[model samples]
Target chain A: MNEEIVRLEDAWVHFDGVSVLEEVDLSINQYDFLGIIGPNGGGKTTLLKVILGLLKPSRGKVTVFGHTPEKGRKFVGYVPQYSLFDRDFPVSIWDVVLMGRLEHKKRFKRFSEEDKKLAYDALETVEMLDFKDAQIGKLSGGQQQRVFIARALVAEPKLLLLDEPMASVDSPMQTELYELFEKLRQRMAIVLVSHDISAVSIYVDKIACLNRRLFYHDSKELTAEDLEATYQCPVEIIAHGVPHRVLKEHK
Target chain B: MIEILQYEFMRNALIAALLASIACGIIGVYVVVKRIVFISGGIAHAAFGGIGLGYFLGVNPVLGVIPFSIAAALSMGIIGRRTKIPEDTAIGILWVMGMALGVIFVALSPGYAPELFGYLFGSILTVPTSDIILMLSLNAAIIAVVFSLHREFQAISFDEEYATTIGLPTERLYLLLLCLIALTVVLLIRVVGVILVIALLTIPAAISRQFTHRLSSMMFLSVFLCAILTICGLWLSYAFDLPSGATIVLVSGTAFILSTVSKSIHISVFSKSI
Candidate 1:
């Protein structure tokens, strides 16, 4: 097996005295594509934030590539949920991609040719090279998500963390993005947070069910029994590969 | 115009206008982008404490406003970072405290407080050469720092969390930005005074943001707008026998309203075409 890229041991998070994540334990391997799915308010976003070092775990430790998340920040790229960004912000796609190289550039020095080349390559990977100078706000939802993916790729990170990459995208774009993710998994590990269990189930090698606590599945094929055990509810895996029964009955 | 330049005071005032315009225009971008107009206003008003201190000590008031304004800006940055307290609340507290301190100090000063009124309303017409030089160097330093850290600033301004994920030192960048804002506020006080400086720092940039989509272009447009507004305000003040700071703010406000209205119309027309 490849080296463990992320190891979280009993991580806990609380907000304003309310327990959000409770005793969560998980491990991600190098080049692993891990999908995280749960209902709303199930601490999916918080878990990603904890792994990104944006929030401190209330208990236990989170190690990314054998170092603290903060120390390993440069080695990981992140695409936060699209909702957090005010798309109206004035910045071009090239400028947004250039931000990915900020850590590498020296103070007062302009971006080198090598940096621009890397940015262009990343843009090409996401099929956004033609929109290099386009304003970020003007892009379609899928296009914006792709640009953000390119921004993350520009860093050449060992691990890529995505939050709901498919939320607002059209169905065809979602399929294309999943294909892109499949290609990306060849180069780096990815931990994607999504509510669309069926869509991600085929692309992800493993799944982690989160609802304050975590239930880990090491196999790509998850059954109704697995969903029931993870969610602690009577869940039925519909024939279409979606856990629709689980959502409907649980609600 | 030649006759106006012949007077030493007029030359000093023009130089001060040039320096103040550049500083305010650059720092104003950050203020507008960050939506920290209230914090900037707090810093400006809080510098009154330093002015009062300078009056009590019989020292240069501009020197006094620097440390006081910087302290206020730093505190605002820190408080906003550390606590979930609404930034507006923190700024309001500091704003009142600083102004109260300034008023008390001025009241306790031994001599008649003739200079206090001038500082409050601004006396650009009587600016000295030394103040002009100071303003010039400060503006140069701000421009150099901003230019050097252009990409980092753009990243942070666009999305602070993404900037951090990319390994940019967001905390340091934010502090540096606040310090620059403090420095700019000090220089601009000579032209717009504390009461009206926020408008000078915000109106032009706010208007320019409507017409540009690039950071560099927005900065350039803001500077041009600010320069035009300053020159027009000065001329209008001369002709109308009005307060320079008030005139400048009024002109910028008018420009902002016009830009906003035209932008809305243009967007509506474009949407209809699409």
Candidate 2:
């Protein structure tokens, strides 16, 4: 197996002639738990989109698993931010997770027993096996988030990309999610993008600051200067306990 | 009701209702769940252009409708997705344009259009055996496509972005769904006509959704409900010598209202008990 999971060489993305991301060069490796911290509209989501092959980078090349993103996306599991879709859609948690096996399915074939087992295993991995038959809409925000994660994991992806997985989660449960990610990191490469810097930094193995351009750091020792550069202001990282604060008083 | 079924026209109408329900029961779930009722409405109305073109060109209206409505659906799908035009605006433009084209084609053809009212408001009582065959085939197509692509449709309907990330061909699946909707619209046009088609395409499924949270159960319940409503409406229309199409729509509407009222009452009762 290739050690390198994703490589972006000077990736650039723009919409309507406006640059959303610029010269972002980064590579993700196996067993890498990368957290991307950026302000809103800093192309964090766009970066993920580029990796998923949803959007083509305007200027540079992006590869996942040494292939084009489209082909490479087969090995990637993605959990988009919660609340981006209609929760009222009639689907059980089992069915939602079964969607992860879509690419693995052959044409004109219904899901096999193996697919069902994988879906169940994915649900179990997220500790949602009890709710497998429950309607997706009936779950709480955090539960739904976990179900979405299970949906991504059902395919047993080698690379996992999540966008703001902690946004809808309650503060009390946020650490639990990070712990889940920590477990997940043991098996696959994980890239998480969020503006919730204070809570995310502790869990990530490496941290990358993004603000249109990216400042890639190989380790989790992110400095206040890097935070200032990403947020475009003076910053601080107060690591007291569960609720660490990455932003400080301006004065 | 037994006596009513003895008449050929009544029997055809009943068969037509059943066929329409099958298509509606399956397709309507997607419409209501995805909230694409407006797009379905647009397709229904656009099918009028096909009907008019059939008359003008001296071809079978149903055959004309298949291509015309499909073309309309493809255009709506592509333009709404690709162009900067807002989706609703594209639907509206295609909708009115289709209706206008129908009117123009009908005007250009010779003779007064007596069946035009049937196409606009439906004449289930006058349905021929040939149209019955068409509806049966369309129902088969709908069932086969839906069953084969059930998972893909579910994924895209729930979260298109996530579906894309999972390597599902979301755009193609979306277009295929639009095409299915177009076929369903054609199936509905014969039962309720263009103006009232959306009701048949959405009401039963909407009602079913209130009772069940699973897609398959919702589909089964909607189909059952639609059949009951269509048959009841047909019987009432036969007894009263009223318009069958309008009667069916009224029955469905009444059912929807009743479901809503009962749900509210149930909620209130539960709250009081709590």
| Best candidate, lDDT | 2
| Clash numbers, per candidate | 0, 0
Predicted candidate 2 versus true structure: per-residue lDDT over B67-137, tens digit per residue: 98999998998999999999899999999999999999999998877899989888888999999999999
Q: For residues B6-125, could you state the per-residue lDDT of candidate 1 as single tens digits? A: 878777877788778888888898888877788899999998999998988888888889899999998888888889987789889998899999999888988888767667767788
What candidate 1 gets wrong by more than 4 Å, as runs, is A221-235, A241-251, B1-3, B270-274
> What are the lDDT figures for the candidates, one per model?
0.85, 0.89
Score residue A22 of candidate 1 by CA lDDT: 94
Q: Mind giving the per-residue lDDT tens digits that candidate 1 earns over A22-103?
A: 9988988899998888777889999888888889998988998888988887888999888778687778999988888888
Q: Candidate 1 chain A vs. true chain A: TM-score?
A: 0.91
Candidate 2 chain A lowest-lDDT run of ten: A242-251
TM-score of 1: 0.95
**Model 2, backbone clash pairs (residues 3+ apart or across chains), number:** 0
Q: What is the lDDT of residue B243 in candidate 2?
A: 86
